[model samples]
Target: MLDKNVNLEGKNILVTGAAGFIGSNLVLELLKTLKSVNIVGIDSVNDYYDVKIKEWRLEELEKEAKTHKDSTWKFVKGNIADRGLIDSIFAKFKPAVVVNLAAQAGVRYSIINPDAYIEANIIGFYNILEACRHSYDNGEKGVEHLVYASSSSVYGTNKKVPYSTDDKVDNPVSLYAATKKSNELMAHAYSKLYNIPSTGLRFFTVYGPAGRPDMAYFGFTNKLIKGENIQIFNYGNCKRDFTYVDDIVEGIKHVMQSAPARKNGEDGLPIPPYAVYNIGNSNPENLLDFVTILQEELVRAEVLPRDYDFELHKKLVPMQQGDVPVTYADTTALERNFGFKPSTDLRTGLRKFAEWYKEFYKV
Candidate 1:
């Protein structure tokens, strides 16, 4: 395993998209793990799905911060696309580690609202790259590592069984996928030009308690709760490497401590100090089986009645635009380098979500 080159304890860290599902869970993990660490978070808290969920996440963060007396948490309500705001935050906090999780995240929504994807995914990410590039001014010790979120959508419709980082991702089927691919390219350019140590994580279908509502698992739960039919896309033939949110956060925490090693090439210039990895369960579950497990878990959690007619609430539908048949991750490199891999079973993960949903919505 690679030696951890960066230590997070007693350091200033910035996490964008603080109120988000993965972002909030990450902040809580950092707070629980590190002492005397100061964290600055930024999120627009837009009403993309539900603002109350974002607000609840921030409230949980507040509670977590109070428990960890030595750690500090400061949240800024704004957008990362705001260049002035981003510059000022970097100047003020001077964070040693920056984690960028803010972006327009839905594949289907991207088709309907392409502008949102360009504005947040493209322009917002560009602003982040520019901020990281300028952080090293005046010979100051700028950002030691930059970790950002990428998606498995970048894999597109490749027939490969398991997607690997070394595989070419030049063909993106959706605008969302295209924008994420763009993020990887932009980070590579910044890393080569300014020598920023950056790593991009291609996450599979991440799901768990307090997750994004747009996700299939969560959306299915919502629809079932209201007796509405949940559409099963690809006629139940689609498969996904559904990863648990906690597992994803654990992968991120490990990556944060180990940035790509910076070195000079034969040409006496930087070697781009860049890397990318896939964090996923590696085991793809068929969509129909996934829904079955979700339904059983919902019943077990008392979120749904045991006698509820699940057959009446599920509808098999054709594949939607911007969707691929399967997504499987090849995590050999991640385990070889970090000695970690996601192992959470789907039933256990879905059970947690069902229980959390029951309590959160007072069902």
Candidate 2:
């Protein structure tokens, strides 16, 4: 098992996409765990879903920041793809640790707007790599670790049940998946070239309260509330390793502390200090079953009437483009290294989301 060696106390940490679901939750976790930590968060706060939710998350972060006497949180509104903005932020903060969570998310959206994916996931990630490289220009032991997000989509219709880090992931069906895979390649090159310790986490179907509204779980609820039928793609013959947001955050927190050790090759060259792991529940829940649980939770939370017609609100449809039938994560590497794995079940996670939805939307 890798040992946790990085000390976060009094250290400057930068989190891109800080107002987004994962980034905001991460900031809150850091404030709770570490004292005297300086957190710098940057986000474009785009209207990919509901901007209100992003603002709400930022509000929560601000509230949490105030509770910690020694810890301070600063929010910057900017795009990661803007090289000048990224450079300026790095120069000012001089963060020792960076968590890059900013990217144009969604599988279907990638088809509609491929440019957005390239600009944000490709160009944006390149800017981050360049910043990390330049941080060492002044002989400063800069950027102890760079942790970024990858996705389960990289598996790309694999026959394998449990998606493993060791599994071959060359086939990416969607532009979004391709970009995520590209990020891993880019990180590896930067790590090998600059000797930067970096890790990439392939998160699987992460959902929770205040999650991206584009996600199926949240979208379905909205459709049901509006008396519109929600599409169940692939004729409801799908399974997802639905990891809760908190569980994903826990995995990230542990990985941030345990970066790959820098090692030198016998040929007098630095071996790439890069690692990637899957952060998921490892339990694949059937789509129809998942919806059943979600509907029950929605009714239990009073977001829907007890007599709500679930069957009437669902439309089973053929498989969509760029979508796989199942996503089952092989988290052996995560468990072996971090001594942790996502354990939250589907019912429990969906219930929390239902309750949060009721309160947030005043349903």
Candidate 3:
């Protein structure tokens, strides 16, 4: 409960992965809401999904930057795993708040390439922690808050209905999940040792317009438009807490304003100022139901014809390796603390994605 507050006005904020889906949306909101703020964004611009979507997000950020009278935006194309690059950025910006959203993102991809997860999610996050540590040199009040992304996948194969922060996340089913859990552990250590006020957000299934094309909703739309069959894993029996990207961004924005307070133990050592919360839609939707809504939305947006044979184009298959049957988040902690919960329904989120897909692809 380190009670630290950041004034976005006249402050420098650094957002890693700023060109990514949630990062870009966050930048736009900051530029729109706060005045006299300087935002520095860095991303590797990797072709994990489509570089075009990242570029499009950056384009939208630039548009918002131009319209703001007092807010400024800077984009640096680089990887967070590079210690020198991360250090240099911190040295130059001396940002009061650091949001580390950059990481190797997919579970299935991690199975194909486990090294990427270690390099980006683990090593990259280590570099971020190191930079935050050094930011406090010379008694400077550096990095009032260090907010980073965690994942609901950390609660691997839990029989629990609603995954909670209080649950033990020792079992990780994927390399990606392992790396994310490692991040929370590492952040806790850093917060304990260096007294870094840190918050880790475990995000559930995030989807929205201009979202990652690898996501099921976006990929389904793409495949359906091309008349290619879309595979529904686990015979379409899985459930997920499909949180809208905007809701995720909103949660991050609210969390950034407050940092854990440093408290001293009886021995006079500062207790670790660390916190973690689940940011997700409380309602879990079945995979088949989610796809059904996606199909309807696709037709409504004219991405698919009204008579499109969704059944014929959907292939029910066994669950892939490194995947869980469900991801239902308990957002009670986030709501209790931040007075906010993700309320965006799956249909509303998928509809926006469908509309964006049609417009972006000119389908």
For model 1, state the Cα shift of residue 191 in Å. 0.4
lDDT of 1 by residue, 54-131 (tens): 999999999999998789999999999899999999999999999999998999999899998998899999999999
| Residue-by-residue lDDT tens digits, candidate 2, 131-159 | 99999987888899999999999999999
Can you tell me which runs of candidate 3 are displaced by over 4 Å? 1-4
TM-score for each model: 0.99, 0.99, 0.98
Alpha-carbon local distance difference test for all models = 0.96, 0.94, 0.91
Which stretch of 10 consecutive residues in model 2 shows the poorest summed lDDT?
A: 3-12
Pick the winner on TM-score between candidates 2 and 3.
Answer: 2
Specify the highest-lDDT model's number.
1
Model 1, poorest ten-residue lDDT window? Answer: 159-168
As a whole number from 0 to 100, the lDDT of residue 316 in candidate 2 is 94
**In model 1, which regions exceed 4 Å deviation?**
none
